[model samples]
Target: MHELIVIEHEAEAGLGFFAGWLEGAGVRCEVVRPYKGEPVPERAGDGLLVLGGAASAWDDEGYGWLPATRALMARSVESGVPTLGICLGAQLMTIACGGTVERGTAGLEIGAGAIEPLPEAADDPLFSALPAGPWRAVQYHYDAMTALPAGAVRLATGSQYPNQAYRLGERAWAVQFHPEASAGIFASWTGTSDMDPLRVADLDARVREAEPELEATWRPFAEAFAAQVAME
Candidate 1:
């Protein structure tokens, strides 16, 4: 069976709906938890999925496995392996490909928000199926991809953060938002940061309300990625 290597940065930010979507598409997944000392693969499988994390991509000293992770991302993209990098993973992909990642001047983009699909996305393998209208997505990141990697095609953009999504090579895709975050996982993220309880509660409610739309928009995207890997 073909495998999709999933890199889970932390325990809390597991694959969520993405795991189920992939499994339903008949693609097996092998998760690697570097935080728990699991080795990052030197070579990728049919596909690679690097999930979200609180840590910055540049914090190699704090997260000793980051350098190796970056190398894995680069290798996967360079070799035309199907790869998807979410949130911090996207930043790492940008940095690994000689792009730039910096603290966002727009402050935190937490909670449910809108992401606009670009014109290039109309023909993209994974993004082509997404709705043409603005899509709501879960956002929780302090850092942003200020510059995309060389030769990358901008698949999507947002008002707060212009670099919302991009396709690196023929098969490598990266997105700044979290399409895989379930309601429970999103709720857990709110309590971690210092914020007003009332505000967190409000955001949690909004995320809950957006669940259906998120599922409609992202579930197909995940399935498409998995199907692509299965075909290879």
Candidate 2:
């Protein structure tokens, strides 16, 4: 069976729905908890799934394992390993490549919002199934990928962040939003973050209502990644 190396940055940002999705697809996941002092491997497994975190990508001093994690991601992308980077993971990939990441000028995008598929995504293996209209997804990042890596294909764009999703080379993909987050996981983030109470409540309600749709849309995307790994 194929294995996907899942990197967990923190305890709060666990795999959520993605765990079941990968298991159902027959992809075994070996999760590395760097926050717990587990060392990140020099090489990736058959595939890689880099989860989100609260720490910035450039905060190497605070998170000592970040440098190794970034190196592994860079190597995976360059070697054509099936790699998926989420939120902070996406920002890390951006910096690993020739791109840039910084505090978002548009402010923190921390709720359920719509991401429209770009024309380039029409033939993308993971994004082609998405509708042309704005597709609802959960967002919780304060930093954003200001620029894409050289030769990267932009997949989706949102109102707050233009670089919502992109594909690096033929195998690596990065998403600024949290497709793996369940309603409960999102709610946990909302409660811990310093945000307006009313806005938090509203977002919690909206995301809870959109749970089914989120599963329906992202499950297939996860499955597609698994299938690619299985084939390889």
Give the CA lDDT, 0 to 100, for residue 129 in model 2.
59
Tell me the tens digit of each residue's lDDT in model 2 across 83-181. 999999999999998899999999889777898888898888888755454688899988999989999999999988899999999989999999999
TM-score for each model: 0.98, 0.97
lDDT (10s digit) by residue, model 1, range 49-68: 99999999999999999999
State, as a TM-score between 0 and 1, how close model 1 is to the true structure.
Answer: 0.98
Q: If candidate 2 were superposed on the true structure by all CA atoms, what would the RMSD be?
A: 1.0
Worst 10 residues of 1 by lDDT: 126-135
Off by over 4 Å in 1: none
Q: What lDDT does the true structure give each of the candidates?
A: 0.92, 0.91
